[model samples]
Target chain A: MNPAAPRPAEPSASAQAVTELLERSRALTTPALRAAVGRLAPPMDTVAAYHFGWIDADGRPTEADSGKAVRPALALLSAEAAGAAAEVGVPGAVAVELVHNFSLLHDDLMDGDEQRRHRDTVWKVHGPAQAILVGDALFALAGELILAAGDDATAARAARRLAAASRQLIDGQAQDIAFEHRERVSVDECLTMEGNKTGALLACAASIGAVLGGADERLADALDTYGRHLGLAFQAVDDLLGIWGDPRSTGKLTWSDLRQRKKSLPVVAAMAADGPAAGRLTALLTADAKKSREEFEDFDEAEFAARAALIEEAGGRQWTADEARRQYDTAVGALAGVELPAATRERLTALADFVVVRSK
Target chain B: MNPAAPRPAEPSASAQAVTELLERSRALTTPALRAAVGRLAPPMDTVAAYHFGWIDADGRPTEADSGKAVRPALALLSAEAAGAAAEVGVPGAVAVELVHNFSLLHDDLMDGDEQRRHRDTVWKVHGPAQAILVGDALFALAGELILAAGDDATAARAARRLAAASRQLIDGQAQDIAFEHRERVSVDECLTMEGNKTGALLACAASIGAVLGGADERLADALDTYGRHLGLAFQAVDDLLGIWGDPRSTGKLTWSDLRQRKKSLPVVAAMAADGPAAGRLTALLTADAKKSREEFEDFDEAEFAARAALIEEAGGRQWTADEARRQYDTAVGALAGVELPAATRERLTALADFVVVRSK
Candidate 1:
C-alpha cells in the first residue's frame, strides 16, 4: 500500500511492444479526432479545441497534453484482435474518444468542477450554456462519424452499438446523481452505476472496433465483456489511488475523494464493512453534513486523514486492490477465448497490466 | 394587432385536408416516437416520457397533450412530395420529433423555464442534471432511429442531415444566449440566429424525409429551403404574438418577451428603427435596466404595456407581421418548381398559411 514499495517488473519485450502500439495508435487516431471535430462550426469547434487543450481560450493554437487516449488504444487493439488493420477502426476510435470527452464536459459542468487537468474547464471558461451545447455537438459528431464509416450494414451496426452504450452511459449518470440524494446506497447499486458510467463506453469502444473489423457477434461480445471487466478494474484502482496515492503523483488534492464525500468504491466498501471503522466513518460523514456548504469546502485536513486511515483499517483499501487485480485477470482471460494473433494477445495482456498496475 | 380581431379565412378544403394530414401523421408517428423512447433504459426513459407528456411525475401513464407535431407533419408532407408513401418517412418523422424535443428539454433547462404546456418542465419536475441526461439519451435515440431505419444509404444520409442541423441548432442557441448580454443586436443577426435555432431542425426534417423517400438532391434542397423560410415566418409571427397577442391563447405570460427583454424579431426591428418611438423604447428599457434583478421579476404591467405600445408605434409590429406574410409567400413559392402533386402542393401551402396565421 505504500507508495515507495517495489513491484514486479513486466516482461520487457511485450511491455515495449504495447507501448509502441499505443503511441502508434495515438498517432493515427488523434488526427482522425481532429478531423471529426473540425466538421463542427465555430465557437463549438473552438470550445472543443480548447477543451482538448489544442488551443488557448483566445483561439491561438497551443501544444498541450490532451489525454492518455486509452479508449482509442483499446479500440485499435480490438481491431487488431479481429485480424483487421487498425486504420479500419479509426472511426470507431474517434466516436469512443468523443463520447468520453462529451461525458467529461457535461460531468464537469454538472459537478461544478472548475478545474480539470490543472486548467479551467470549458464550462468555467466559456460558461455552462456553451459547455452544454459543445458537449451536444461532440455527441452528435460521434454518431455522425460512426454513421459515415463504411458500408451501410457495418456503419448501422456500429452506430447501434454506440447508441446503446450512450443510453446506458446517460442512465448510469442519472443513477449516480440520484444516488447522491439517497440515504443509503448499496454496493450492488454502486457497482451497477459504475458499470453504466465508466464501463459502458469502454465496452462499446472495445466491441465497436471489432464489429467494424468484421468480427462476428460472439467475438465482439467477448471483447465487450473483457472491456467491461477492465473498466471495473480501472475504477477500482482509481478509487484506491483516491484514498492512498500521493497527491503529487495523482495531481489531486490530498484525500480529494473524501473531501468531496464521493461514494467511490473504497468508501462504499468501507461503509458496507460493518466494522467499528464503518461506524466511525458514518458518524464523521454525518457530522460533516451538519456543516454549512461553505464549511464543507474548507474541510478539516486532519479529519480527512482520519477518515482515510479508517477506510484503510476497515480493509476497504485492501479489498478494492484485490478486486482490481481479480477483474484485471478476468479481463485478460477473456482475450484467450477469441482466436487473436499472438502479438495482439500479448499487447492486450500488457494493456491490462498498464491499467491495473499503475506502477511503471 | 389586437387578439380579438378577426382574420382572413383560409380555403376550407385545403385547411381541412392539411388538418387531416397532420392528424394522420401524428397518429402514425407518435407511436413510433414512444416506441423509440421506450427502448432507452428506465429513469432516462421515465424522464423522457414525462418530457413528452406521456407520463406524470409519479410515473403513471397520463393522457397529456404533446405539441403540434409540426415537424413530423412537414416530414411526412415532404415525403409525399417526393412521390413516396407517408409510411416510408415515419422513421424520419420520429427522428425529427425526437431532435426537436431534445432541443426543448435542454433549452428549457438552460432558460430556467418552470412551465411548458401548462405542466412543469422536466428540470422542474425531476432535476436539471437528469433533464440534461434524458435530453442526451433522446438525442442519441434520434440518431439511432435514423441509422436503423430501413436501408443503409438512406439512413446514413438522413443521419448526416440531422447531425448538421443539430450543430446549427446548437450554434443558434449559443448565439441566442450570447445575444442576451449584448446592448444591441441587429435584426439581421436576430433572423440568422432564429434561422439556426428554429429553422435548421425544421429544414432538416423537411429535407431528410424527401431524401429518405428517394427524392433527388435538387428536390430535397428545395424542400429544405421551403422549411427554412417557413421557420423564419413561424418565428416572426410568434414574436409578434409575444408582445401583442393574448397570453391566454399563447399559453405564456403577458408581454413575456418584453418582460424577459428577449431580443425577438419585433424588439430587434424596433431597436434598429432609428425613430422617436425607438428612442422612447430605448429610454424605457434603459430605465428598466436600473432596476435590480428582483425588481425585474416584479416588473410593472403598465411598463410592459407601454413597451409593447412603443414597439408597435415604432413600426416594429407591422414590419414583423408583413415580414411573416412575405416569408410565408416565399416558402409556398419554393414548391412551385418541385413538381409535387397538386394535393401535396395545396397541403404544403395551407400549412404555410397555418404557420403565419395562428389565430389561436
Candidate 2:
C-alpha cells in the first residue's frame, strides 16, 4: 500500500471538516493579506503580487495556487479555541501567511529552486535582487500588520510571538544549510533542525491568535505544543513523499530530497541504523557524494531508486511512518491537556490528520 | 579647496558639541544594542557580532570601527526633545540601528560590495546565504526589541513607524537596482530614490523616540521632516565624496560612484544641465556603457577622471554642494517649527551642520 497513491473521491469526515476550515481561512485571510501587500511600492509590490499568485508575470490577474493556508487556519481556529470570534484572529492569520511566503521566497532563492506551486519562483522570474527585496518587504509588512491590529499591548504581545518564531525559522534554515555539508548527522540533530525550520512557525501560528485574544500562557503553551508536534508529523510525512510520492501530486521529481542531498529525517535515520544494509547505504552515498562533487545533478534514476531501496531495507521508511504516527498522536494528546471546546479540539485534530495525510 | 581634505585637529564649536552628543549616544546605546544582538542563536549571533565590530571574524573580541551611530543619536535626542530622558529612547535607538545594519548587510550582498568600514562585508566573510539569514535575524530582532520596549500602545506605534520606514528603505533599494539598468535617470528621480533609501529610515529614527515617549503626531512629524532634509543633505555630501573625496578619508576608491555608473545626485544634475560639457558627458557615458556591457569593472582611471571633470565642468558638483547646504538649512529650520528646549534644538541643528560638511 503506497501512501502516496490517490485516494477515493469520497472524502472522510475529518478531511471534509479540514477542507472547510482551510477554505474559510483563505476567504478571511487573503483579503487582509492583499491589503497589506498592496501597501508596498511598485516593482517590489509587483514582484510580491506575482509571488502570491495574485498576478502573472506580465501583471495580468490570475488565481493561482497560493498555498494551503494551513497556518492561517490554525491561527483562526486558535482564536475560536480561545473563545474569541475568528475575526479577531484575521491580523495574526495574515501576518503568519506573510511571514511564511516571505520565507518561501528567500528560501527558493537560497536553495536554488526555480519553481514553486507549479510556477516560476520570484527569483527566477524577477531577478535574485528583487527576490531578496520583496521578501524583506513582506517581512516588514507582516510586522506592520500585527502592530496595527489591536490595542498597543495586545498587538505587541502578538508581534513578539511572531518575531521569535521567525527568528527560529531563519536559524533553522541556517542549520539545514550547514547540515548539507557535513558527512554525519544524528537523528536528534536532524529533528532539532526540522523542529526549528517547520515546527517553530507552526507553533506560533497555533497560539498567536490566543495571544492576541489575551489567552493565558498555559493554554497558549498547550496549543503551541500541539502545533509543534503536528509540524514534525507534517515534515515526516513530507520526507516520505519526497522520495516516494507521485510527481503529479507532489510537483517534484522522484527522490527529490535525495537528489538535493538534503539531510532530511529518513536519510539521517537510515544512516544511523545498524546493519549491513545501513553500512552499504552509507558507502553508496559516500561514493555518490565523491562522484557528484562537481555536479550532483548528473546522478541516474536507477541509482536514486537503489538508494531509496537501501533506505527502506534498513528500516528508515518504517521508522519514519511510525514516527509520523507517534507525533500525530502526541499532537492530538496535547489538546486534551487544555480545556478547549470539543468542537475546537476536533477541528484542530482534523487539521493535524490532514497534515499527516496530505499528498501535496 | 578640496572639500574632502582632512580638517585641522582643532575642531569648531558646533562640531565639538555634536561629537560629544554622538559619543554619549553610543555609550548609552551600545549596551542595549549588544544585549539585543546577544539574544540571537549562535552562528547568526557570531556573524552579527562580526558585522557590528563587537567581535572579529575569528570570534575574538575586537572593537573595530562600528559605524558612527548617527541614527541612534537622532533617536535618543528625539526622545529628549519630546521631554523624556534619553534612556527612554534606547529601545528606539537600538531598533533603528538594527534595521539600518540589516539593510547594510543585504545591500552589501545585492551590490556585490566586498568591503564596508574598511573590513570585509558579512557576505564576503561568511558567504551569501549567511549574510541573508543573519540580516533576516537582525530584522526580526528589531521588531522584537521595539515591541517589548514599552506599553503595548507605545510599542505598537513605534513598531509601525519602524516598519513603514523599513518598507520605504527597501523600495529605495529596488529603485536603485532598477536605475542601474536604465539609460537615463532624472535628477528628481535620483532625489526620490535617495530620499527613500536614506531619508525614510533617518526620518523614522528621528521620530521613533518621540513615538515611544507618547508624543503626538505633530511633534513626530516635525522631527521626521527635519530628519528627511538632514538625510538628503547627508546623501548630497556623500555623493560629492563618492566622486571627489580623498579615498583615505572616505574609505572608498576615488571616482567610486562613477566607476559603478551610479546615477547619483551630481551625475543626474550634470546630465540635466543645458551645456556642451553635459552633452559630451552623456555621450561619453553612453559609449562607456556599451563598451563595458560585458565587464563593468574594466573602465580605466583616466576615463573615470575624465567623467568626473565633465560633471564638474557642467556644474554638477557646485549644484550638489548648494543643494546640500539648502537641505541643511531646511532641516535646521524644521526644528524651529516645533517648540523644544533650546539645548535640544541647538544640538539637532549642530548635527545637521555636521552631516552636510563632514569629510567622510
Candidate 3:
C-alpha cells in the first residue's frame, strides 16, 4: 500500500510449492474434519456444513472457499519435522482446523462481520444463536479429536496444549474488544494482544503434530517459536490488507478493521509515530468515533481513503510492512535451532513466506 | 397450583442426609474448581468468579448459592459405587460442575434471562461478549480437567462420554429453541428433547466416576440408566417449578416458562388431553403468542393466572406429578439392578428423592 515499503517479488516456483502443500494437507484433513463435524446432531450438523462451504444453505452440495487451511498444513509439516509421515498428523491437523473455524465463527459474530471469504457469515445466514451453538460444537469436537488421537499420556498432553492456546486466543479477543472503548493504546499493548490472539494458536498448530507424533519437547518448542513469529508476520500483513488491499482480493470491505474501530497494528503504530500527520489522524479518528457513537454508518469511502493516506504519511504502513519482513526472517531463523530434515525446513520456510505475502 | 396433585412429604432425615452429601461433595470439589478457574487470565477469571458467587459484581467476596452441587455428589457416589474413594472422583466432579456452569452461562445469554440464583446473570453483569467467552473458557477447562484426571485410556473414555453428552445437551437446547416457534410439540418429542438436554449429562455424571475408577462398562451402564431416569424425574419437577413454584423459593417469576411461551411438559401434555379445558387452554395460548409476537410483555398476571388454572383443569398438573413419581420409582429401581452397598444405595435413593421434591 505504501510506495516506500519494499515488496518482495513473488517467485512462482515457491508459490506453487506452498500451494501444493496446502492442497495435500487439505486432502488429508478434509475427510477427518467432515467426519468429526458429521457427528454433530441434526440441524446443527447442517448449519456447520453450510459454514464449512461443503454444502449450500439449501443443503445441496457446493464448492466454496473454506479458508487457506494454513493451520492444517503447518500441523502436517510439523509431524514430518518430527520424523513421522504426514498421515500421522492428520488428527492434529483436523483438530487445529476445527479450532480455527470455531474461533472464526465466534469472532465473526462478535465483530458483527457480515461476510467472510466473499460469502455471508454463519451468523448472517443462520442467526446468532445457531452461530454460537455451532461454534461451541466445533470446539467440543476439537477436544474430542485430540484426546482420541493417541494413548492416554500423549492425548492428555496434546489436549492440555490445545486448551492453553484456546484460552489465550479467547483472552486476546477480550482484550481486543476492551481496546475499542479506549482512546489510546500503546504499541506494546497492541503487540501483546496480537500475540495472544494470533500467535498462541499458530504455535499450537505447529507443535501439536510433533506432540501427537511423540517428538521431544525441545523439538516441539522450536516449532512453536517458529510458528509464533510467523503468526506476527501473518497478522501484520493482514492489518495492512485490511486498509489497502482490493476488496475483491481480500473478500472484505475496504478499510474493514478501521470500520470496526479495531486497535490493530497499523492504527496503533500510526498513532505512536511522531509527526503532525499522526496528530491530525488522531483528531480525525476521535471526531469520527464520536459521530459513529450516534450514527455508525457515518464514514464514507472518501473519509476512509483520507485516513489511509494519513496512516501512510505517518509511517504506519511502512513500519508494519517492515515489521512483517523482520518477523518472517526471525521465524525462518528459528528453524536453524532445531535439527529438522533439509526438506522439512525448506518447506516450513516456504510456508512462512507464503503466509506473509499472500493477498488473502 | 393444582389441588388434586399430591405433594410428596419430605422426611427430615433423608433431607438432612442429602444435604450433608452435597455439602461434602462441594467441600471436596471447590478447592480444585477454584484452582482451575484461577488459571484463567485476568478479567476472565474475575468474571467467572462473579458467576460462581465467589465474588460479587464489585469483586468483593460473598457467600451465595452455588447451586445444590447435585452432579458432584452423584459423581463421588458413583466412584464409591465402583469401590474407589470419593477423592478419586473429585476431578470428574469438578469437570461436570464446570460443564454445568458453562451451559448455564451460555443459556442465560441465549435465553435473555437476566436473573439467576437470586442475582444478575453473567450476561447482565458483564456484556454478552464476556458471557460468551467465559462460557467457552469454562468448556475448554472442562475438557482439560477430564483428560488429565486419570490414565490415558481412562481419561479418553471419560472425555468421549462427556463429549457425547455435551453434544446431546447442546442439541437439546437447539430443539428447545425450535419448539418455541412451533405450534404444537408432541409429548414424545418433548420427552426426547428433555432426555438429550438433561438426561444425557446426568447419565454421564453418574457413570464418569466409575469409568475413571476403571469399572466395567456394564456397571457404568447400570449407573447410567439410574441417572437417566433420575434426570427425567428431575426435569419433570423443574417443569413444575417453572409454572407454579413460589418466586421466593425458585428465584423466578410466576409463570416464567409460560412468559416465554415455552411448550414445556405441562403445556404439551395439556394440549394432548381431550376436553373443553384443553381446547380453551390451547386457544388462549395461541392468542397470547400472537399478541406477544407484536409486543412482548403484553400478558399480565391475571391472564397468566387464568391460563395456569386452565392448564391445571386440563389435567397437565396431575399428569406431570404422576410422571415425576413414576420416573423417580424407575430411577430407584435401576439402582437395584446393580450390586451396591446398602448405604450407597440408600444415599442414591435419597438424593433422587431430594431432586424430585426440592423447592428450587
Best by TM-score: 2
Error of 1 at A156 (Å): 2.3
What lDDT tens digits, residue by residue, belong to model 1 across residues A206-254?
8888889998888899999889888988888788787777877777888
Q: Candidate 2's residue-wise lDDT over A53-79, tens digit each?
A: 999999999999888899999999999
User: lDDT tens string, model 1, B118-205?
Assistant: 8999999988777778888888888778877767677767787888888788878878987887778999999999999998988898
- How well does model 1 score by local distance difference test? 0.82
Task: Encode model 3's per-residue lDDT on A1-360: one tens digit a residue.
Answer: 332222355557778999999999999999999998998877788999999999987789999988898999999999999998998889988888888888888888888888877788899999888888889888888887887888877877777788778878887887888788888899888888888889888999899999888888899899998888888888999898888887788878888877777778888899999989999999988876666543656768888888889999999998888888888888888888889988999889889878877887
Decreasing lDDT order of the candidates = 2, 3, 1
CAPRI level of candidate 2? medium
- The CAPRI category of model 3 is medium
Give the TM-score (0 to 1) of chain B in model 1. 0.96
Predicted structure with the largest DockQ when compared to the true one:
2
lDDT of 2 by residue, B192-254 (tens): 999999999999999999887778989999999999988998899999999998888888998
Two-chain complex of model 2, DockQ on C-alpha atoms against the true structure: 0.69
TM-score of chain A of each: 0.95, 0.96, 0.96
Candidate 3, superposed: residue stretches over 4 Å from native: A1-10, A57-60, A274-297, A300-306, A339-341, B1-10, B213-216, B274-289, B293-297, B300-306, B337-342
Q: B135, model 3: CA deviation in Å?
A: 1.4
Rank by TM-score, highest first: 2, 3, 1
The lowest-lDDT stretch of 10 consecutive residues in candidate 3 chain B is: B1-10
Candidate 1, superposed: residue stretches over 4 Å from native = A1-22, A35-42, A56-64, A79-85, A210-219, A270-315, B1-9, B39-42, B55-64, B79-85, B210-219, B271-310, B339-342
- Candidate 2 TM-score, C-alpha based: 0.93
